[model samples]
Each structure stands twice: as structure tokens, then as C-alpha cells.
Target: MAGLGGTKMKNTWQQVKKVGIVHRLLSFWSRDWFLKVVSIWLAIVLWVLVGGEDTIEKTVNVPVEIINLPRGLVVSNQYKKKIEVSLTGPRSVILDMDDRNIVRQVDLSKATPGTMVVNNDVDHIDVPRSLTVQRVQPPSIILSIDKLVQKQYAVVANTVGDVAPGFEVKSIRMNPEYVMITGPGSVLSQLSALQTSYISLDGFRRSEQLQVPLDLSPAIVSLIGETSVTADIVVGLVVAVKTVELPLVVQEKGLSLLPKTVSVTASFPQILLDKGKKAKDLLVAHAERYGQTDQFNVIVTSQNNEEFPVKVISVLPRRVSEGKAKLLRATTKKKSE
Candidate 1:
């Protein structure tokens, strides 16, 4: 029995030893160079799937030199003369660059009096290892400068308001219409003709007094600190007056009229009656001759009485040859009230 027990234990020990040997052989195969290389390649593929390349866009202000500036040309208000630029590329490259590495410039030497065209030559930007220039904000610019001759005109004051009803404007008066202005000879020659201050009252109702500021069209620097003309406008309302004419006619009611010539007469206020008295003054009038007549009456009506007081006065030629009398002349009375 003891011998059999020892045989059984030996067989178990042999099986355990075979298992250990198999494990050692598997470990050796796993540590092989070719297998180790394959595992590293798989790890790299997984890393690429999880992490991607970084791309970013950035904006920067690039400094530039203006070449070929024209003689006698001066640039005013050139504080922000740098060009605005935008760049896009790999994140690493863009983050490594600074604004000083970029260059911007405008050539004024070849410029003219008018708008000078700016060139879009942007080859001066020193980009980082991986970044490149994308675009510039203002591709070009026009440098406006003072020419030889320049002229300035005074600014006029325009009113806008409403006045009381039943009144009209009598007259409008302005203090000064023009001012003296001198600048570059070239600019002055172009501005040979000057315009007086123009007052515009598009929708004015009430009386108004305003001190308006003057503005120069196409603002020029030469007119700075120059003397400007001041103006005062007077607006008033007056009564409205109207003129009318009555024709000379003959009419009679209870008289057996005979054949005879008749005359006519008219009367009115000096201002109303005096207007167009002669052919030169008479804007329009009409009269017809008739025989002897009776029953004569002159009729008059008011046209516009809002401002001026108006009324009929007297008439001439009270009777005619026929039963009807001819209307000679009629008159109207006018007062300021």
C-alpha cells in the first residue's frame, strides 16, 4: 500500500512539472522581438484614434514701412497706421509668432492729389515654422491731402417751426451770407466759386431763432481755425391780401331806356386800388359799353381777409341810357388791423 501511494504522488509531481515547463515556453514566445514590435505599433494606432492634430486661427496687427512717399505730402491722423492681419495654420506654429514679425507699408511717392491707390503686397510677414498668412483687413487705402487752392463758404442757418394761424411771412433777413477762406493754391483754384449760406425752411410753423453750427462739405484740414460768418434770420407773419376785378355792365328794372353812352367808376383803399392802376400796373381788367339805362348797383366780395381789413367804398356811373345803368368804378377800404 505504501509503494502504491508513492507512485501516485510521483505521477502528480510529474504532471505539475510539465505544466510549469509549458508556462515557461509561452512566456518566451510572448517576449519575442517581432511580437514586441507589433504591440508597440498597435498602441500607436490607438493613440492616433484618440488624439488628433490641433488647428487654430489667430488675428494680429502687423507693423509695416511706407515706401516711396511723395514729396511735400503730409499724412495726418496716422496714429493707427499699422495693418490688421489674420493667420491660420497649425496651433504650435501660430502660437510662436508675434506682431513685430509682420510688416505693413503704403507707398506715397507715386501718389497723386486725389485718392491714392494702396498696393496689396504683403510678403513681409515672418510666419512661424508651420503657420502662413491668411488675409489683410483693409487691402488698400486712399490718402486724402490738402491741394494747392482751397476756399471756404459760411454755413447758413435754416429754420423749422410754426407760426400762429391767419398770418403770413413778411420777409426773411440774414446777417452774413459768405466768409473768407484760403488754403493750398490748387485747392483754392478748384473752389473758385463760393456759395452763400442757404436757409432751408421745409416745414416751419411757429417763429424760431436758432444759431446753427456751420459744416464744410468734404471736410478739409486747411479750413481749421479759420473765421466763420455768423448769420441771424428774422421770420414774421403778416395778413394776406387778395385782388379782384369787376366788369362794367348796364342793367335797369322799371325804365323805358333810350340809346346813350354810359361811364363807370371804382374805388378802394390806396394799397388795393393803386395796384395795377395803369396798363403797366393793371394785371387784368375787362369793360363793355352800353346805352342809357337805370337800376345800377355795384357788388364787391372779399377774397382773403385773414391779415388785412377790407371793405367796399363807392361806385361811379349810377345810371345809363337804357333801363340799366353801367357800373363805372368801384373802390375798397383797407386797414392794417
Candidate 2:
């Protein structure tokens, strides 16, 4: 009996061991394991078919970058800003590259003051390790370098629009009439002077003083002195000239004038003329009250108000005939004396 029981226990243990062996074998062929093997094999096959020792050419635009420029020097000419690069490299690497990955570098550290021609090649360009440079559309570029220079230029004031009706511009004064500027010699040599921004004088009636900035280019030129200037504008009163006719008045009784009117020229403030005041309203003529003869001198005066001062320029007739001129008849009855 004991032997039979031991045999039964041994068979059971053997059966359990066989089950464990089967489980171990099944673990190697599970769903996750099968997927991993398939993915690796597919990746290898695809690599061999698509990117194995194969090269392709592609054209891309790369920006030109300048570096290592010497101090106090500038490039005066605008050359090719971008270049087309034809690259021959592995298909896998070329397909992955975008416009940001490639760039052409230009070294101007040793440049001098002259026209220089630089060649484009792989040595100066930055690219991926797997890609090779085949050709460049513009194989060379020309640049002009110049020394920096500075000079003083006169500043002119510019004004736009007109002043008030009764006022005129007396004078325009700029505090600093000149400005010092620094820039490339090629551009600075051609510049003569600078101008201020347009100053609007529209509806200006009084003297004005303001600070105005100068108009200058920011890219290539720099101002060394004060960027702003003090503009002093003076406005003065305007005088208007006008002419009018006034009736000649006789003060003495029984006195009559031959010419009833005379032309009077005067200068007055422009403000008074624009206030609906006629030139004739400000003119008057007077005669002497004690004059015995009919002829008298017509004195012209301006009746202008206190606000408007009028200056009499001229009078058409200084003397007037009030029927006073008569030929004394010495009873010439054929001189019947």
C-alpha cells in the first residue's frame, strides 16, 4: 500500500512539472511578445527597403548669416540675402530636415574696406551629419565693406499749414542748428543735411516754443548729439492796407464843394478788417469852420477804434473846390472904363 501511495504522489508531481513547462513555453509566444517580434522585424525590413544605402537630392532655401564682423566696419551693399542649396544625402536624413536645420554662415572677421567676393560651399554651411552638400545655386556673393565715419550736418526746420488770419510768422529759430551723425562712409558721404519733422502751424495765433525731434534713419545712421531741438516760432500782428472814398464835408455855412468825395488810403490791423468793419466806416474828412472862401483843405483822419490803429497813407485830393473859385469881373464892357 505504501509503495502504491508513493507512486501516485510521484505521478502527480510529474504532472505538475509538465504543466509548468508548458506555461513557460506559452509565455514566449504571448500576444505582447508576438507583437514586439513583428514590429522589430517590420522595422528592419522597411529600413532596408526605404533608407538602406540610398541617397536623394533636394532643393531648399537657406538664409545667409553674417558673423564675426570687425568693429567700426559695416557692409554698405545689399547682396544675395538667401541662397538655394541642392543637397544629396540619405533619404531618411534629407526627409527629416526642414528650413530651420540648414544655414549658410559668412565670416567677415578679416574683411577690409573694399569689394569682396566670397565663395559658397559646404565648409561654411551647417548641415546634418548624414547629409552631403552637392551644389549651391549662387556659388558666390559680392559684398562692399566700408569704414565708419561721422560728420556734422545742418538741421533745417520744416513747417506746414498757415498761421491765423490776423497773424504772420515773424521768425523761426532753431536752438541747435546742426547735428552730428555717425554712419558708414559710403552712405554718410552722400548725405548733406537733415530735416526736422513737419511742424504744424495751423491756427497758430501766438508765439510758440517747442521741442521737436529730428528725422533720422535707425538702421545705418546714428545721431551723436541731442536728438531733439528747440524750435522758437514768433508770431506777429498783420497789418492790412485798404483804400476807401469819403465825402468831403464843409463846416462853414453857405459853403459848397465842387468834388463831394475823395479817396483815402489807410493801413489797419487785419483783425479789424475781418470783423465786418468796412474801410469807409473808418474814414472821415473835415474842413475849417472859420474859412471865408468856398475853397478849403480837406483834412482826412481815421475814426478807427482803440483796438485797431489806422495809419492814413494818402489822400487823393489835398485841396478841394467848394464853388469858391470865381473870376473877379472887372466890368469888362469892352473895358468901358
Candidate 3:
């Protein structure tokens, strides 16, 4: 039983917006390059020292971008997403700055697949000499690197809360059934199947369709193509009904039943009715032993059947003639096994 359960960009890929590696790069530069170049150019020109201006300190957050990382390796640890730089510069120059285009670049040209720490310096910021670097919030970065690998794993739907009160999750279907991901091999090896983030079943009484992201650890892995999947969850009743024919017998007062078989219909808990369970395995029928003479009503119960409870909904041929064919007595012949 289960019950219910940011759009931001960083140094890591934006999951929802990233279509693929090639498409993302092309679209990013094409859409953003012109504005970025113009902003930097204007900021540089205007940054020339103003003779009599007062200097002030300002802090800005700059996005971090990783470059030149080898294709065979991936960073496995959480690194700085943004560098917070506090700069002291002329008031006029600082006010004219558009830091949106400013990015802190981290180069991995000489990097290998292992744990490493790198220092973040004030020089990484591209401000003119008029601005002096006062401080950087995080002076150093630590990262774990591992061999990059690709794998495909089956997808599972996840949910929280019980579906209504008398309902069950009959089945779960994923549109693509599986997911392919590119990530660090050490982390990928620990996973067998990818699971979607939890969806709510709180008071939900019927099937529904949902779009959910995979439950993945940050910085350790990245989805290859589709970032989220379509999930179809089926809900159904908790009880099941079945009809079966079983031999009816009499065990008390030395009496017998004439038509010694019956068609019995029963309702059973769906939780206990898997492939190995059957009507005969959970029900027994016999002629009633009480409250009648020469004629008895058929009694059905699941008494000796694994202590599981069953309800008799309908029993065809509800009564039988006793001691005759006309009321012919049922007989048992003893023999050697």
C-alpha cells in the first residue's frame, strides 16, 4: 500500500528542456549567443575608469559551465552550480553591468576518471581592471569522476496512498516500457530498473495517465533522450467471483445425496486469488446435516481450505432428494489404495 507524494537550470543539463546532446547545443548558442556577445561588449566598453566615481562592492551569481570533458568519463559528485563573486568596482560601472551573460568556465582538458579538487579563483570573472575581486563564496570544488557508460533498464511506475478504499492497482503500463541512460558506470551498476517519481493515488478510484521524471541521483547520471515518461495505471475492484462444479457429499447421520454434485459460485478476496488458487481449492460442498429429514439443502463452505474466507453467492441445484432416486442414497465403496 502506498499513498501520495523546480524549474531551474544549473551547471547540469536542464532535464525537461534538453532534447538531446546535439540539438541542445545548437539551439542554445543560436538562441542566446547574440545577446550574450552584445552584453559583454557593452559591459567592457563602459567599464573604463570613471575619474571621480566612488567605488562600491556588489555580489553576483555566475553560472558554471564544464568544457573539454572526455567522452569516456563523467563527473560523479556534486560540484558548484554557480560561483558567487563579490566585486568592488566604481558605482557607475557596477550598475551598468548585466551579469546574465557572465559564466564561470571550468576546463577539464587534463582531467582523468577519479576524485579531484579544483580551486575557484577571482580571476575566473571577466571584469576590467576597474573592478577588484573581493571574494568568492566557495574557494574550491570537489568532484568524483567515473567511467561513462550507457545502459537500458525497465521502467516501473511509482505511487503513494491507497486507491479509494475497496480498489487495487490492477496493472501499470509504461508507454516506452524501458529507459536508456548515459551515466557513471559505478552508479549505473547499482540500479536494476528505473523508477518514476511517486504519483498520488489519494482518493483516486479510476485509472489515470501521468507524466513523471525518473528517480535519479543528481550529478551521478543523466537521461539519454526522454527525460520523463507516460504512465498508465489501472485500478480495479478488490474482490473476484468464480463458479465451479464440485462433487457434493454427505458426512453426517449416515445419510447421502442423490445428485451428488453442484455448480457453486463464490466470491473471494482478489489478494489471495493468483494462478495457484482455484474454486475447488478454496471451497467445499456437502448436503446440510441439520434442520431437515429425508430432504436437505446444499451447504457450501471454504472450511478446510487454508483458513481463507469465501462467500457463497449462488449455488445451482440448491436442494437434493435424500434416500431416493426418488431419494437414492449416495454410497461409498471401500477399496485398497
Candidate 4:
């Protein structure tokens, strides 16, 4: 019985030993460092087989923006503003790039008043990767456009200087007072008024005609067209002459309570004087009675063939009694050439 027990015990011990050996071999192969190294090598071989160093070419459509345009002006040409890029690169890099990375620039400085077409050249794009441009979709674009117009504005007149001595300017008048302008709407909108040059009338004695130039504001002039306009101005002058008092002389058949003398007043040039005309020729008289006034118009004629350059003065009463006679004193004045 003891021998049999020993055999059983020994067999069990051998089985335990075999189990320990198997566990030791398994632990060696399952270590973290060994598995990590094997995985890295396997990934490298797979990448090599898939052409990791090789580049792939592809074309893409990238949208871009334009800048610096005049106010009210629109971009009417697409090809001039947009571009398509044909790029060849590693698939990973190319697929990761944003549209903005591949840019297109179009210059519009020389643009005119009509539709413009812009054709983008794929070669202009600068790609940092091992990539080559392949194609551009919609190679060109068209832009439509129009010109803008400005509005009319008012101009103020500035006057200077005085009229002749003893005379004054009563008023001034202008024809076609305002000026019209045409240009870009943005610039025209900023202008509120126009101004004329300084007008000097320093020593003028009689009525005169003047021509003044119209000056436009910078905002209005920038966008103007070929058409232009002129402004017409008219200045009026009023003069005051020297005046004197003259007495009236009444000598009619109807006589009643006659007055010793009556006076009249007149205005004329201070340089010229002639006094050889009768009262009827140079003076007029009138009378009022019972709230009714009588008026008369007198014509002055030289009776002595000597031109009495004098004009009729106003009567003292302006009117007298119908049946009374009255005498008037006369004053003379000289006239200008």
C-alpha cells in the first residue's frame, strides 16, 4: 500500500511540473515590449506596400474673395476674380487641406465698363507638399456691370466792392442759378453745395454784366462725365442823383386869391445846367378842392433854342386852387457826359 501511494504522489508532482513549464513559455511570449515591437514592424511593411512615399495628383475647386473696389462698382467678371487649382500630392495631405490654403488672386485695376471674364491658371498656386495641380473646374467666370450717376447741387454767389459815389446797388439777379453734375453715386451723395469765385465790383458806377466760374467739390468731380454746364449771373445797380427845389409859376385867365409864389423840386445830373424854358415847358401843377385832387403832366421844351438840360421839379402844394394864380422859384443843375 505504501509503494502504491508513493507512485500516485510522484505522478501528481510530474503533472504539476509540466503545467509550470507551459505557463513560463506563455508569459515570455505575451510580454508588452515584445508585442509592441512586432506591431510596429508589421505597420511599416504594410505602409511600404501601399506606396507611402508616392504622391497622388488631383484637381479641386477653391472659392476666393476680391477686395478694393470703388464704391457703387460691382464685380461682374468671375474668371477675373476666381480660380481653379489642379494639385497632386500625398492622398493624406491633399485630403486634409482647406480650400483657402489653395488661393487664387485676380487683378482688377485695368477693368472697364463692360462684362469681364477671368481665366485662372492652375500653375499660379503654391503648394508646399509633394503635389502637382491636375485640373481646374469651370476655368472662367463672367461679371456684369454698370456706371453710376451723380446729382445736381446749388452754388452760392459771393459779391464784393461798392458802387459809384452817392449811388448804391439795389439788388442782383441770377439766371439758371443752380448747376447740374453727373458722376458716381457714392461720391455725388457726399456733395451738398458748389461755390463760385470771388466777384469784385469795387468801382462800378453803371449797370455791368459779369461772368463767374463754377467750382465743384472734390467728391462731385471725381466721378463726373464729359458733359459740363455753365452758370449765368446778372447784377443790377441802382444810382442816386442830386436833386434841387424849384418854385412853380401859375399864369392862367381864371384868377382868384392868387398866392405870391409856389415851389417845385426836381432831380438831375450835377454837371449840366440850362435854364431858358417857360413854366409850362418845364413844370406841371395840380390843385385839390372838396377832397378831390387834380393832377397834371408837363412837358419841358427849350424856347430859346438853348437846351435847358434841367428837369421839372416837384410843386410845393403839388396842387393849387382852381381860380388862383401862383408864381414858383426855379433851380438849375449840371449833368454828366
Give the candidate number with the greatest lDDT: 2
| Cα lDDT, model 4, residue 238 | 30
Q: Give lDDT tens digits, candidate 3, residues 19-100.
A: 5766878877898798988998877766654555688988888788888898798887767799888888889778766734
Q: Choose the strongest candidate by TM-score.
A: 2
Stretches of candidate 2 exceeding 4 Å from the true structure = 1-50, 53-56, 99-101, 160-166, 173-179, 197-232, 239-337
lDDT of each: 0.49, 0.79, 0.75, 0.53
Give a tens-digit lDDT track for model 1, residues 110-149: 6656554565444555566466678876776555553444
Estimate, for each residue in 131-250, the C-alpha lDDT of model 2 and write its tens digit: 788888799999999998878888888899999788889899888877677767988887777777899999998899989987666543333543778999998768878888888877
TM-score, one value per model: 0.34, 0.50, 0.47, 0.34
What TM value does model 4 have?
0.34
C-alpha lDDT of residue 55 in model 4: 72
Model 4 vs truth, CA RMSD = 18.5
Tell me the lDDT of model 3 at 51.
54
Which 10-residue span in candidate 3 carries the lowest summed lDDT?
1-10
The per-prediction CA RMSD against the true structure, in angstroms, equals 18.4, 14.5, 28.3, 18.5
lDDT of 2 at 68: 97
RMSD of 1: 18.4
Order of quality (lDDT): 2, 3, 4, 1
Q: Candidate 2 — worst ten consecutive residues by lDDT sum?
A: 325-334
